[model samples]
Target: MTAAVRDIWRHPIKAHGRERLAQVDLTVGAALPWDRVWAVAHEAARFDDAAPAWAHCRNFTRAAGSPSLMAIEAEVDEASGRIRLTHPDRPEISIDPADPADAARFIAWAGPITNPDRPQPARLVRAPDQAMTDTDFPSISLINLATHAAVAAEVGQELSPLRWRGNLLLEGLAPWAEMDWPGKRLQIGSAELEVVEPIVRCMATTANPVTGERDADTLGALKRGWGHQICGVYAVVTQAGTIRAGDPIEVRP
Candidate 1:
């Protein structure tokens, strides 16, 4: 098979917004650079900055809990440590997450968009070292286009890859081929990644990225058609190098 990277994406803040990228450098034993570097801690969260660690997704404002979060777009300026957030229902705002005052401003801006029934957003929390990914270990998410096509067919509608929220989108792989990739290694350009595990489908996939509406029964479709709720795979970087869209991907035994 002639698999190649079709797109690349990074989320500077977890479950908030996605940023498209043409190319990115992968480093050994780390999440994507600047990806999920910050997360919004909700009122019920118990994350401690003194000894920061990966906490459950419930501690942060996420798309699964608040579909409205998917409607937002973010632009992060790593040099300035400033993030610009734009939402359809509200005016665009720029805030420096490093500043306590600015973090408070972000919390205020996000309050209404997130679920009011749930705990309110309190502050923005920065990961002490690596980005705050869903998995316990640092990894990148990969999705096969053919697998997405199969899911869309099962749902009887066109689906957006954004709902999957994967870091790398690969084309030319057979449907569900990625399910067998765990324990295998893949080479993209000069970087090598070892597939770690399959990513289970979550309620977040049901939310439309553009409208932020819960329109699709993705989990139901996956269960009914695939007999499982997985759509993507997580891989840990084993060799460090730059990878770009359209780069040829090779699977290694």
Candidate 2:
């Protein structure tokens, strides 16, 4: 099916906030730039601060564990290495998570929204020249708007695309068409990426991005409708190039 990019997004901090983009540059064998570049490790996390590496999602403060986090939005000041975060129930903050003082400030700001039953947000760690995406390999997630619509239809609610937390959002494809993309290449704008696998979703998808509450049973809807709990695909870039919204995407042999 023919499609074009509808939106682009990146999460500088894993599971914490999302930022929209009109254009981005994709590099071969890399995740989207600044996407999940920094991740907040919880107090009980098994992460190495001195030697930061890619740890599992369980080691971080994610929306799945704290639904309130889903409401957070972010904007990055790349030149200043700072990020501005805003939530519905909390005061807006602009801090460089890498700084000791700023990290403390952020931890305090995010403390109330985090799940009190679970480990608390602790240190902000940077991934070494790579992203902290859920996948072991650096991946760019792609979500189909048609598939999202189908899931929304099943749930009997109109859901925000932010629930998927994908890097690329595409439109004009058949519902669930991305499930067939594995092992195929997609030519998007001047970039080409190989589809690796479908992204198995989690409870985080159930939360409402606006209210940060579990308002929908997205996982249940997916299981009931498709017999699977996946809504997006993971892809690794193969060609370095620029891509933007409105650029055509075609499945390649």
Among these predictions, the greatest lDDT belongs to 2
Query: Candidate 2: minimum summed lDDT over ten consecutive residues — where?
Result: 122-131
The C-alpha RMSD in Å for every predicted model, in order, reads: 1.0, 1.0
TM-scores for every candidate against the unseen true structure = 0.97, 0.98
Per-residue accuracy of model 2 over 148-203 as CA lDDT, tens digit each? 99999999989998999999999989988898999999999899999999999999
Model 2, position 113: C-alpha lDDT score:
99
lDDT scores in order? 0.90, 0.93
Give the poorly placed runs of model 2, Cα more than 4 Å off. none
Clashes of each: 0, 0
TM-score of 2: 0.98
